[model samples]
Structures are given as C-alpha cells and as structure tokens.
Target: MKVKRYVVDDLPQAVQMIRSELGSDAVILNTKEIRTGGFLGMFRKKRVEVIAAIDEASRKPAPRPAAPTKPIVRKSEPSEESAIPAVQLPNAAVRERYARSTGTSDAPAVRTSAVPSAASAVAVAVPAESPSKEAPERGAFAVPDDPRPARPVQAGAGLAENPDTASLLTELRSMKEMMVKLSKQQTFRSMPDSVMNWSRRLAEQGVEAPIIERFAEEVNDRLGTEGADDESAALSVAREVLLEWLLPSAGSGINSSTRIVHFVGPTGVGKTTTIAKIAADQSLTHHRTVGLITSDTYRIAAVDQLRTYADILNLPLEVVFSPSEAQRAFKKFEDRDLVLMDTAGRNYRNELLVSEVNSMLSPGEHAETILVLSMTQKYGDMKSVASQFAKYGVTRLLLTKVDETDSYGSILNLALEYSFAISYITCGQTVPDDIRPFDPNEWVSRLLGEPAYA
Candidate 1:
C-alpha cells in the first residue's frame, strides 16, 4: 500500500492530485483543515490536508480474454518459412473502439498462418506484427483447435463499477461522516458571548479554564431558571454559587488526651518554618507543654536551624534519621501535652519519598497530617503537588505565602477540587505573628473582589 499526504488550498486540488498520482483505486483516509503562517495569530492562511492511500496489488487491471484465432494448416511438405505461422494482433486503439461499439472488450482480432499445431501457431503468430499497427493491417481472425479460457463478461465493467472503486467510495463516506461529527463537536464547544466574558475575567484572575467553565455554566443555569437575563444578575448568581459550593475544611482541635501534628509538603514550601511558628505558639502563647521532633536530617545545617528555635523556646528538640528512630522519639515525648513533628521538605512528587515520610510519621494513627502549599505557585502545579501528598494522608490544607500574591484563586480552586479543609493561612515569614486559623467568610469575600470580613 502506498500512502501520501497533500496540503492544498481546496478540496478539488487535493482530489486532482490523488487521482493523478494514485489513479482511480486510491482511498481517502482522512482530511482536516490547518492554519499556517500567523504572527501572534494574525493573518493566518487556511489549508486542507488530505491523506490518501493506494494498494499497488489492487491497481492492476484484470486480464481480459484474447480473441479466438483459426487453426493454422500445415502442408505435408513443410517449407522453412511455413514451418512457423506468422500471427498479427490488433492494436490497443482498435481493441478500445471494438469494446465501445460492442459493449465488450474481452476479444481482439488476430491473423493466423498455416502451421503444424495450434500451440506452435498461437505462440509464433502473435510476435510477427507490431502492437502499434491497426487491426486491418494485422489480417483476419483465427480460431484455435483448443480454445483458451474466456474472460468473464463482467471484467469489461466501467471504472465506477470496479470493486476497488466501490471500496474507495465506502472509505470516503466514512471519512465524510467522521468530519461531520467533528464539526458538530466544534460547534457545541463554542461558548456564548456572555459565558466567554466571564471566562476571560476568571482567566485574568489566574483561574484555570475548566474551573471557570464550571462556574459559568452553573451561573447561566441559575439565571435562566430565575428568569433573569441581566449581566449584574448573572454576576451575582456566579458569586453566590461559588460561595455556596466552596466547602471550607472543618476539624476539631487535636485530641486533649495527646496531640501530634506532622507538616508535609514539597521542597521550599516553608514546612520547617511553619512548624517552628506553631511550636512557639503552643509553648509560649498557649502555655502548653510542647516537644519538637524533626526528621529533616537530609540537608546540611537543618538540625542547627531547628535547634536554634528549640533553644530559644526552651523546648526539647529530637532529631531522628529513620522511621524507627522517629517512633522512639515520639515514645520519649509521650509525656508532653503536644508533640510537633517537622518533616524535611523534599520532592513529594516522588512516590518513594512520600512513602518514606509516611513511614517516618506513621500519620493517621494519632496525629493530624497537614499538607502545606504555597499561594505563590500556579494552581495547575499546586493541584499535582497536592495530589501526591494526598495519596499518603492529608487531613487539612496549610496554605503559605499568601502575602506574595493578591490573587487567592488557588485557595478556592484547591478547596473545591480536592475537597480538603483549609486549616491555616501563613501570610508572612514572621513566627507566630503571620500564621492564623482559616476563616471561611473572610476568604470568600476576598475571592469575590469585595472587602474582607472583619
């Protein structure tokens, strides 16, 4: 099979090229419109790309039956020249005209001379004349003693009636049907002008298209149902729907009997610093007995940094290298009212590292696992990063670096997408001063571009 691709200005040109190169047996496999030569999507030219194929074996014409010839007569005394009977055949032009006149072309004219046998004359007679000569010049017809198999009458069918042509038409119809279905889908995907306006607004605010579409669709539905078509009414509906669907994470304070908190997130997400701030609050501000355990032994000077905070707060800091050692450290701090576990910030995208961290903390046994994400990162990246942490265990969301960007769409986006509770928001790097528990109403107001709730 020979397959080719052609890009042309229109369908007719593509068809002509396919016909000239692949002949009548070619099949169109696929076609699509493509745009090229655009700078920033301006002044682009559209072209049609067509894919066609031809099966080399199917393109060969089926052999037709030759015209019957008379048997050659051989004299008892054979002359040298008479020994081989000279035969002449009609040229292709004569054969074509004969076919048109009689509605058949299986038979052609053949002139025969006297010879010894039917096979000898049949072989020797045909080579005697040039194929370019006319039928009359080739002489009269002859019938052989033993006739060859006759070509089927159906072999003379027109090009349109050919089996290969029928197969090609079927393929073309299938491609046309597929193209129609794709066009319908393209039409269905085009959004209304109002919906598109909202989509642009959300995109400017750094919200992903899928999330914007979901909100816009719901807003439109509510407006239609309430018999309101105004833009302000639509915006109001959108805000209300978003607020209603934004389910804030809910949780009770840690168990009074024993409290353990583990902080986990990707690299440089402020996991260690966040833990320090929490430790200072629990020990100094809340006046509770707090012990700190860190499995951040992978990096240089990590223990020193945490130890400095531990020394200032006068709290015991135990650094463990392995999961078993971590278990022992927890056992040693069992008498304390609260034990804060700070894990090293590594690539959580690596499943092995996440599993190792899970083993080290033994989360969900008695401790609350918090996944920390940064508001500075894109929502698209945050979703993937959060999912990797979610695989092990994540009870709450500890969103950090809120002061870095005014847009807080990532907070709302993650809340709706993953269904995880927003636990705390860390705005600045200040220990114990910048971190605060999440407030649902205040966050919703910020997301809607309104004044934050007091």
Candidate 2:
C-alpha cells in the first residue's frame, strides 16, 4: 500500500488530487483542518489535509498486449489481378467485441472475401460470439422516419466529459464522503476494538449509544494516561465511570418527619402495584403506622387492586377524586406516620393532566413527589415522560420492571437527564419481595457486566 497526504484549498481539490494519483481504489485514512501561509498564526488560510492510501497490487490496471501482424501474401500467378481479394474491414462493433472477449486490443481483422466462408471463419476465430448474432445497423431495420426525439446533450458538464469516467469519479467521491463522515462519527461513536467490545456489551444490555460512547471514551482516556494495556484494566475504568454516573443510593427510608409520598407517572407504569409494595413494606416489615390514599379513578380495576392490598395489610384506604378530596384524605391520615398516595395514570404528553396531578399532590412541605417509570420503556420515551412530570417537582424516581430487561443504562440516563435521584427499583409483581432499595455499588457492578456485588 502506498500512502500520501494532500493539503489543498478545499475537499474537492484534495479529492481530485487523490483520484488522479491513487485512482478510484484509494482508501482515505484521515482528514484534518490545517492552516498555512500565516504570519504568527494571524493571517493563515484554512485548508483540508487528506491522508489517502492505495494498494499498488490491486489498483494498478493490467498492461495491454502487442498488436498482431498482418500475414504476407504472395502472387499465385500472372493471371491473379490482385494479391489480396477486394474485401471489407470489420466494423467498430466487431473490433470492440473482439477486444473485450480476448482482454486485449490491436487484434488484426481478416478480409471478408479472403476466406471462402467468412461467417464460418468468424465462428472458428471467436467461439464466444456464436450464441448471440451481431446487431443490425440502426437504420437498417427501421420504418420510414424515426419517431423518437433526439436527447439534448448537456452543456458545460464539469467532470462529466466521459460517462464512464464521470461514473467512476462520482462513485469514488461518494465513498470518500462516507468514509469521512464515518471517521468523524468515530470520534464520538467508536472506540478501539478492545474497549469497543464492552460498548457492544452495553448496547446489548439496552444501554443507549450516546451513554455507551461516553463510557468507552472515558475508559480509553484513562487507559491511555495510565498506560494500562490490558482489556481487564480498561473494563475496570469503564465500571468506575458508570458507577460515578449512576449516583445510586438507598431510598430515604420512611421516617417520622416524612408524612406523605405521592407516586405519579405515565399509564401502566405499575403506580398502584408499587404503592402496594411500599405500603406492605412499611406496614408489615418496618412495623410503622401506614395508610393508603388513591386518586387512580381512570382504570377499570385500579381502585379494586389497591383495595385488595389495603385489606391484606389491614390499613385505612382513602379514595379521593379532586385536590380538595386529596387534602381531606391527607387530613384523615394526619395521625399516621407514613401515607402513600397513588395518582391516576394519564399520558404525561397532556400538560393539563400532569398539572392537575401536580396540584393534587402539592399539599404541604411534608409531601414528597416520586415519578415512577418502567424499565421496559425506551430511554427516549422515558425522557419525554420525565420532562412532562418534572412540573410535579419530582423529588425522586421509582423505576419498575427491573427484572424485565438486561440493561440498566436507562437508570443512569434518566438520573443525568432529569437530575432526579433514584429511590427504589421494583423487579417483579410479588409485593414487598420484588422491591429493593437502590444500592450504588451493586447497581454499578451489575451494569458493568459483573454479577451484583450485593
């Protein structure tokens, strides 16, 4: 492979130089902005410097063969008028065909009348042409006047003088552009294969590309500085970066000062189920005075689901419709140590619905709003859902369905995007048993492709 660099005024000039020197089979390695002809770097002109390389063995075209010589003819007798009989030369079409088939130019054509059977000689000379007969002249088989209109040739067609050359150039230019784009994207999207293996692992776990890119870069940068060449060392750095970004913490356990905790988010995110789990944990496990208040009147069985859990726990359940009713319920549960309120699940896309729920939960300083999200939902959709519910002054995040997915990147993504702390993660449908408080080290270890340290 031959490598060369061209610093030109613009990309087009660099491309032309590469094409002229390297032909269309060159691969672009790298490109960068360069400044030249400057006085103390004040008056420099900007230019693009391209680094291109081509394999000599592959790019070089094969050499052409020497043309065949004409045979010498001798006069048979004085009666023979001419040494060679009057015969027509083969047309341009036949010459081109012979050249293509033999992969060589300058092959001499024999006179038509010199051989008694001209067609038979042609069949013997070029056996490949036997399957398809030669095409007739354009006007030979045409009816009286041609009806098809002539195509107008283009004017001042730059870099398109020859159709074949233009096609090659266009294809080369397209390839160069794609390579350049991919090269640029690699700065943000790609990493060395050693580190990239972890990036793919993260992606397979359902982590978003941008987050994986960041982790890979951090790992690579750390490895570069420390001169740690081992793959395990790079993975350690990745794990550290993810742990720092995750910011996981155990949920602020129910305390005396904490009076009301309201759960709010989009539809079917297990808001009621989550509340039931927490209620069970507080009432049965923690042995605290726990009560339930719900405004989830949308679903057909939301109220009944909560009622069943409330009956099992043997705690007072308050069903409210409006903010006033919620306030009244808060007053009813004032004596309790902890009150878990479940709000109606509505599409957070509607501003009015979020605002209404926000108002319902915005009762007093003791009230803490926690936005519940499902792990099964995409990070992008989670971002949208979080943005809408952010107006609720979300204090913490409660992620549901952790057992349903392999990836935990969405947890870190939402934490960074919304700046909301994760309090708990519910993994299964079993009340109290499925829920676990967020543990920083354990979550990070699991996310970075290690078994949970917990």
Candidate 3:
C-alpha cells in the first residue's frame, strides 16, 4: 500500500489532491482538523489533515508478456465440435455491458464474474462498431445487441453474481457516509476554544443543534480562529448572531387595537398571573379600561386568584363555565377598551383538550390568543404545547417563570422554530412588576451569559 498525508483547507480540497496524487482508487483512512503555525497558541491556522492510501499492486501497471508459441489445432471427433478459448474483454466493453444489464449508468464494472457459463465464457470480444456482414464460424459464440430498453434492476439483485464488486461498492458507500457524519460532528471542534465553549453552552441551554451550528459559523466567519480566542470577542459576535435571529420576533407584544386577549397554555405556566400583569399594565400605565374573564371553574382557586387581582385593581371580572357563557361575558365587556380572558390550563399535549379550550376563544380581528409557556419546562413539553396551540392559529407567545431556569435557549428555539411572536416574559410571580414586553437584546445577552449589550 502507498500512503500519503495532506493538509488542506477542507475535505473537498483534500479529496482533489488525493485523486491527483494517489489516483481514483485511493481511499481516505482518516481525517481531522489540525491547528499549526502559531506562536504560544495565539495565531494558529486551522486546516484539515487527511490520510489517504492506495494498494501498491493496483497502482503498478501490469508488465507486458513474452511472445507465445503457436497453438496446435486438434481435429474434432465426428459428433464433437471445437471449443474456442474464452476471450478477455477490455474494461470499457465490460462496463458497457454491465451498465446495459443493470440499467444504471454508474454501476461498478468488474473484470471477473462469480458465475460463468460456457456460452458466455466462450463469446468472442469485439470492438465498438457496426455488425459485420460475414457470418461467424459454426462453433464460435457471439454477443448480439438487444434493441429493447433495459429494465430497472433491484438493489443487490446482481450482487450474488459478483460478490467481490458488490463488497467493494458497499464498503466505499459506508466510508462515504461515515466521513459525512464525522464532518458534521467535528464542525464545532474546529472552532477556537472560546467559540467552542459558547457552542457547548448553547447546547446545554437547550438550543437546537442546527441553530447553534449556524451561530457558530457566523461567529467564526466574523472573528476567525485568532480573534475567537478572545472570549469577549466571541461573545460579542455570538450576541449579534442571536439578536439577528430573534429581532424578527421582537416587539411583538399585544397590539393596541386588540380588544380581547385570550391567555392559553398548559397547567402551572402562570396563565392567570400573566393575565393580571398585562391587565394591570394596560389599565394603570396605558389607562385602558381593562375587563377580566375566566373559564377556570375546573379549579375554584383559579377563578378566585384572578378575582383577587381584579378587586385590587378595581377591574370588572366575569366568570364563565362553558363556551356559551363565554359569549355572554364578552357582551358585558363589549364597552370596555380591553378584555383579558383567561382559560383553564389543561394538559394541552392532548389535542382534545386543546380543541376544548380553543372553542372558548373569541375568534375575530379584535381578538388575539397568547400561548403562555413556562421557561422552566422541558423544551420538548414546550414544543408540544406550542404545536397544539399552533393548529388553532395561536402565534403569540408569553413565556413565564424566566427566573426559575438558567437556560433561555428555549425562548429562541420557540421563536425560530415556530415563528412565535414572543409578546411578554415574566421573571417572578409579582403581578405587573416582574413581567415586561419581550426584549431581544436583554434575552440574547442572558442566553450567552453576558451582560446586556448596548
């Protein structure tokens, strides 16, 4: 075997060099990212190191044979015909035949056959040309071209007839797939230490892998390997990338024109508390006439909790037991500037429950639904709730319990994946105090564990 090593910018470059130096039959043994030419690890250049090898026997050309003596012709018996020796066809002819037989233009063509028959083995090899006028001798065998279109061959259909070729192709395919997986897995490892740490932090924060990869790519492009060593620089670049991802969904709080806002989510996500905060802000700070409605009779305390806030804020409160009653409650608050309707929190992971709660929501241009999710919840659970609500066109999001979890990637995950407009986020249970409109800058800063950027 002939082995060679190459250091290149990427896998494609290494592949091109290997093919040129070691021929097309060469296989890659291993590949990894390596850093070089740095003084005290300050300004190293990152490159891919690839090891490739090719069989020496395959690389060396076959030697020419000495001239052969003439063969003595033996007379055939009366009932026996003369048998012709098998002809060795060129590689191009064998490939053409294999392609036609398999109906695949790129099928691997091999020299030897696993099963050979007398007729096929004795067939005379010919050059690519039109059929000759003269007929063949009585005992000679010839291959005729078929005019019919080739049929599609099933996978591994011809493998049993050519085990060596099939094995080679399968091994090559496996190697290619392995290389692709390794490339993806090592993508973040190629980044500088500071940048790689942030990638890990984002993953630990529950961010999706694709989003983290894109963020890392953007940061690496901006800072490069040398500058990425500076943690501050990496954080600054990461902040900008995250902000760009989140800015589209920022400042998407409840519109002033919306008169009825329905707060919906799973249990223990602080739906009632979030309603109170928004209602208080609207009534006291914006001076809008706010009315409260609740369909939370499932838990008597749920209704009483909102009633307590309504009494303290001097806002009109209405309670409904069903969708029909909800209509009547809306009529009573028809004159109010803004009505905040709170729905009973159920296991929204169940589509039936989502539909039941969805039935009570006011559907019109004047109403909006806010899916309240707790940041402390698992990302999978949050995604499930969001997906169920999304079926009913609930695009607005209000994340609660932000102070309870250190990981905020779920916020960005929800925003980017579902395109949910994050309207508000609550850090504490304090009504109208801990809750505020979603701030992209502050949230991105927190996600990266950095101070809020200017």
Instruction: Name the best candidate (by lDDT).
Output: 3
Local accuracy of candidate 3 as per-residue lDDT tens digits, 358-446: 88988889999888899889999999889988988888898889888788889889989999888888989887899888889898878
**Clashes in each model (backbone N, CA, C under 3 Å)?**
6, 0, 0
Alpha-carbon TM-score of each model against the true structure: 0.57, 0.58, 0.64
Q: By TM-score, how accurate is candidate 1? A: 0.57
For model 2, residues 45-125, the per-residue Cα lDDT tens digits are: 998899999999996679754322333233333342333322223455545655675666754442222122313322112
- Per-candidate Cα lDDT values, in order, are 0.72, 0.74, 0.80
Model 2 TM-score, 2 decimals: 0.58
Query: Rank by TM-score, descending?
Result: 3, 2, 1
The order of the candidates by lDDT, greatest first, is: 3, 2, 1
Name the regions of candidate 3 deviating beyond 4 angstroms: 1-137, 140-176, 451-454
Instruction: After the best TM-score superposition of candidate 1, give how far the Cα of residue 93 lies from its true spot, in angstroms.
Output: 24
- Please give the lDDT score for candidate 3: 0.80
Whose lDDT is higher: candidate 1's or candidate 2's? 2
In model 3, the clashing pairs are none
Regions more than 4 Å wrong, model 1 = 1-198, 225-232, 250-258, 451-454
Clashes of 3: 0
